[model samples]
Target: MSSSSHLIIKNGTVITSSHQKKTDILIVDDKIAKIGNFTSDDDDAGIIDASGLLIFPGGVDAHTHMELPVMGIHSSDTFATGTKAALYGGTTTIIDFANQSRMESLNQTLDKWFLKAEGHVYTDYALHLSVTVVNHQTIAELEGIIKHRGVSSFKTFMAYKTMMITDDEIATLMRETSKYGGLVTVHAEDGELIESIIENNISQKNIAPQFHPINRPIVAESNAISRLVNISERENLPIYVVHLSSAEGLNCALNKSNAKIILETCPQYLLLDDSKYLHTDPLEVNKFVMSPPIRPLQNHQHLWKGIADGHIKVVATDHCPFTLEQKKLGLNDFTKVPNGIPGVEHRLEILFSEGYLKGQITLNQLVQVWSTNPARIFGLHPRKGDIVVGADADLVLFDPNIKHTISSKTHHMNVDYSAYEGLDVVGKCQGVMLRGKVAIDCDGVLKINEGYGHYIHRGACVV
Candidate 1:
C-alpha cells in the first residue's frame, strides 16, 4: 500500500496515560496534525470510521531479543518477523538489545545489530547496548554510546556466566554510565548461586525440565535484586530491573533504596506459574524454560499489586524464542535448553484482558506501562508514545470487546509454540497506524511491508 499524506480517524475514544476522550485525529504525513471533533473538506484525505473503537498509542516494548544468539542457537524470530508480530499486537516500537561479545568492542556490537535490524524490521526500533565485559576501554566508550550513538541505556546481566559481570564491574558501569546520563538495566539473578545449584541438581540426577526452576530458586532473584538495590542506594545511581519474577524479588526492589529503582514484569510472571514445569510432557514443560524462570503461583498477586501501586514501571516481553527442535537439545538435560519464549505478539492483548478487564489496573495505567512508560523511560517519548498532536501517529484501533483464543496456529511470531496458547484474551488490535500511514486496516489486513521501519535514535531516560 502507498503512503497517504492525509488521513483522518473519526469517532474513536482516544486513550492516553492521562485521559480518554472521544475524539477525532488528523494526520498529515508522519505527524498527528490535529485532534478533536472536526470535519475535513479535502476529498483526497483517507477517512477511517473508528466508531466504538478505542484508539491507543502503539505499544513500546522496552525489552525484546530478535534473532539473538543464545546457547549456541539463534532465537527463532528475525527482526522482520518479530516486529511484524509486534505491529499486529499494537506494538509499533521496540527497544531491542544489542549484545556485545566478550571479544568485540561495543562499537562492533552496535554495528552488527544495525546490520541485523536496518531495513529489515517492520516497526520502529531502538537499541540498548548489552555490556558483557568491562575494561578501561569499555568504560571509555560510555560517553560516545550515550551522547553520540543515541543509546541511553546499557544492559547488564547478573546471571549467565558468559554475559554476567562482577559486582565491581557493575559498580564501575553504574558510576561511568551515570556520568553521561545513561541508565543501567539489569537481569537480576545470582549467577554464583544458580551455578552452584545447577551443579548440585545435575549430580543428583535432577536434570529434568521441572528442575529448571528448582535450579534457580526465588532467593537467587531476591538476593541479586537486594545487592543491586544496595549498590544503587550507596552510589546514588538509578537502575532498571528487568523481568522481575518473584514476590521476594519485588520486595527487594521496593526496599526503600534512595536511588531510583524501576521495576519491570512480564505476562508469564503475571499469569503463568511454575506449576507449568510439572506437566507430564517434557516438550510442554520445555516451553516454560526461560531464565529467572516462572515463579510460584503466589507471586502473581504481588506483581499485580506492584503494578497497581505504581511501583512497576514497564511490562516488556523478553521475546527470545527457540523452536521445539532446538528445545529438544535439552530433552535429557535442562541446562542445554535455550532460555526464553515467544511473547511479542501477545503482550498488549494479554495485559488488556488480564490487567484492565480484571480490574487489577486502570486503563490509563495499562496504557502507561504498556506504551507511555517504556517510551518515556527509553527516551522515545512525545514521538513514540501518546496521542497528542505533533506526536508520531503510531496508533492502534482496538476492539475491547473482541475475544479470541491465543494459539500458535494464529500467532504471527516465527516460533512454533505459544507460551500463552489456549488462553482467552479480549481486546484485539483491529487497525494499526504507523507514522500517519495505515499499516493494519480495520479488517486486520497488513497494509505495510517489511523494510518500512526506521531506526530511532533515543535520548536519556526521562522517568
Candidate 2:
C-alpha cells in the first residue's frame, strides 16, 4: 500500500473502550483521515510501522490542577511543565479546576487560569468552574462559563468549610448546574465532622500527622458522600464524586441510583495507606497528606472491583505538585501541609503494568477507565479519546516490554520526591505524537519548545 497521503500507522492493534481490532490509521492535516487497511496517495505522507504493538485511545485525565493557585502558595509545576509531563505519560487531555476564592471574583479566577495556561499546554484541556460563593452573581456567572466558555462541569465542596459553599449554597449550585445541562462534581468530606475531630485530637495532644486519617475517618467521607448522593438523586442531577478514598465512601456511591452518581478515584487511594504516616518525626507524614487521605489497603481491592464493575467512571492524577521545602512547612503539624501528589506522568504506565498485565483488568477496561470514559464525561470524547476517523492523531506508541523503576530524578513533574518512587512498571511511552508531530521519541527525548502547545477551546456535553 502506498503511504503518501498524510500519516499512516500501519498494522497496529487498535483498542477502543468498546472494541478491539487490528487496523491501520491514516491522518490528514490534524484529524484522523481514515482507520482501516488504507493506502494513501500524498507524497509528503509520514509512515509509522506499528505492527506487533497495541494502540489505544489517548488518555483523558478529567481531574488535574496544573499551576493551580491555592492556600497562600501556588502548585509547583507550571502549565508548561505539568502538561508536558502528561503528554510523556500518554494523556492527551486534562480538565483542571478554575477555582474561585472567597474574596476573588469568579471572572477573575477563570481569567487567571486561562492566562496561566495560555501558550503552555502540550495537549488539549478544559476547565470546571468551582463556585465558592452561592450569590446571584456567582450563579449568573455559572451560565456564562457554561454557555460561552464551554465549561460544563461545576465543582463545590462539602469539605474545606472556609473555602467551600454552605450546604444550602451547595444545593443552590446543584440546582443551577442541572438547569443548565451541566454536571456537579463534589469533593465530599464533611468539614464540620472533620473539624470536630481535629479539635478533639488537638486537645488530646494528638496533633501529629499520624492523627490526620483518624480525624478524617472513613465515616466522614461515607456520610458526606451519602448526603451528596441523596441530594443528587432528589435533584435528578448526575453527580461526580472526585477523589473518593474509602470503601464505605465507595459503598455510599455504589448504593445510589446508578444513573445519578459516578465515582472518580485517584491512584493515591488505590496504592497508599494510612500506615505511611505513622511516624514520630512528623516529616515522614508529609508524603501522605492528600485530601480524603489514603485509606486502608483493603479499600484498594474494593476500588479495583469498582473500576472493573463500571461504578467508577474515571481515574485522574489530581496532579498537584509540591516540593520538599514546601512540604517541610508542616513539619510540626500535618494539618498545614498542602494536600496533593504529582502522578500525571505515571498514571498510564502504572495502570498498564499493575492493572492490565497483572490480570486485574482486561485491555478493553483499561482503555475505558483511563481514556475514553473520562473524555465522554468531560465533553471531549470522540475528539480526544478514540482513534477513529475525524479524531486528532494525538497518539502514543507504548512499548510494554520495557521495565523501569520510577523516581523523582527521572520523572518529569517539578517535585523533589516521587510519591511512586521505586515502583517498577513494565511499559513506557516508546513514542508520542501530538497532531502527527513527534513530541517524544523512544530514546527519552522530551521535545518541548515554547509555543509548541496551542490553547484549545473546548465544547460542551457529548456524553
Candidate 3:
C-alpha cells in the first residue's frame, strides 16, 4: 500500500520492442537494479505478484498541449490535471509545447511554462520550443536553448497565420538548429489556400461544422507536405510531420526524396471519420472540430498500412481540449471554434484493442510506436522508454483481457466530452509506477501527490 525503497515485480510478461519474456524486475530506489529472477536480501522490500499480467515500459506521449491559449480561451486541462490523467492512462512522460510569442524570447517562453508546471505536475514532462518568428535573434539563441536550456526540438507551424513562418524562414531554422543537434518539427498544412477556402465558404454562408473540413481540403495538406518534403531534400535536413491525416498527404510524404520524414498520426484520424461532422445536433458536431479534421473512412486503411509497413514511426495524441461552452463561441461560425479534442487517456487502450487485438499490428509494434519510438525521437531514450537495467523504473501493469467502453463519464481529462465516447477497448492499466514509486495501484486509484514529477533534461535525438 506504500512505496518502498526496494521493490520487486515478479511473474509478469515483459513486453519490449524486440521481444517478450517472463521476467522479474528488481527496483532499487528510482532505477531498475536487476531484470532476472532473484530474491531480495532487504526485509522491507515491497513485492508485487504480477501473475498473468503484461508489464510494459510506461508510455511517452510526444505531443500534447496543456494550458495552451488559443482562439479566445485557454485549454481546459492544466499541467496538474493533464499529467494526472496521463498517469492513469499509462503515459508517464509527455512532451508539451512552450510556444514563443512574437515579442518574447525563447527563454522567456520557457520560463513562463516552467512557472506553470514546475511544482504542479503529476508525471515527468519536457518542453519543445515552438518558433513563431525566425529572426537573427532567434537563430542566435538556438545554441543556448539546445545546449543549456535542455530543449532539443523546435516546432514550427506551416499553417496558422500567427504561427506560420515563410518557407525561407523554415529552411533557415533547419540549417541553424541542426548545427546544435536540434530537430525541426512541423505542423504541415497550406495556410494561404485554407484561408482562401474559408473566405469563400463564409461568403456562401456555408459556415457549419461540416464546412470545417471542406475549407481545409485534402489538397491543402498534401500540398504543404509536398513543399516541406521538397524543402527537406534541398536543405538536407530531417523533418518531423505531425498528425498526417489523409492518404494524399501520406503519399506526398512518401515522395522519393532523400530526406528522412518521420510521421505521427492520432487515434481520431485512424478510428473515427468525417461522418461525425454531419451529426444532426450542432453541439455534437462541434466536438470533432480539430484542425486538419478527421478524414474519410477509406483513409484509415492507408494509415494502418503505413503503421504496419513501418512508414509511420510514432502515434501520439495532440491532446488539446476545450469545454462545450467554449465550443459554443463558434457554434454558427466554424472558424471561431477552438480547434482541439481530448484523447490523452485513451491512446494506449485504443491502440491495443484496435491495432493489436485485431491483428493490424503486433504487441511489439504497438510498444515500439507508442513508447520506444517517441522516446528515442524526442531524446528521452533508455531512461524513459525501455525496461533495461539501469533505466528509470517507469512501468505499467496491464490486464490484457479486460474489456470496457470509453465514455466521458468515466474519463479523467478536464474536458466534458470524449473524442472516443462509446468505443469498446481491450487491455487496461491495472497499476503504474513512476521512478519505482507506486503512482497508480491495482485498483486504479491515484496514490501520488502533486509536485511529484520532475522536469526531464533531454539529450540529442537518437532516431
CA lDDT, candidate 3, residue 381: 90
TM, every model: 0.98, 0.95, 0.98
- Give one digit per residue, the lDDT tens place, for model 1 in 1-463: 4356888999999999989999999999999999999999888888999999999999999999999998778999999999999999999999999999999999999999999999998899999999999998898888998888899999999998889998778889989987877888999999999999998988998898889988889999999999998888888888899999988998988887485789999988999998899998888889999988998899999999899998998999999999999988888789788889999999989889999999999999999999999999888888988999889999999999998999999999998999988999988999998998888888889998898999998887875
> In lDDT terms, which candidate is top?
1
What's the C-alpha lDDT at position 45 in model 1?
87
The model with the greater lDDT, 2 or 3, is: 3
What ranges in model 2 sit over 4 Å off?
A: 1-5
Ranking of models by lDDT: 1, 3, 2
Residue 161, candidate 1: C-alpha displacement in angstroms: 1.2
Q: Which RMSD values do the candidates have, in order?
A: 1.8, 2.1, 1.8
- Deviation in Å, model 1, residue 72 alpha carbon: 2.3
The 10 consecutive residues of candidate 2 with the worst lDDT sum are 454-463
On residues 1-463, what C-alpha lDDT tens digit does candidate 3 reach at each position?
3454888999999999888999899998999989987777877888999999999999999989999989768999999999999999999999999999898988899999999999999999999999998988898899998888889999999898888998889899988988878899999999999989888988999988768888888899999899988898999888899988989998989996596788999888899999998887777888999988998999998998888888888999999999999888888888788999998898899889999998888888888888999899888999999999999999999999999999989999998989998898989999999999999999999999999999999888765
lDDT of each: 0.91, 0.80, 0.91
Error of 1 at 123 (Å): 0.4
Candidate 3 runs further than 4 Å off? 1-4
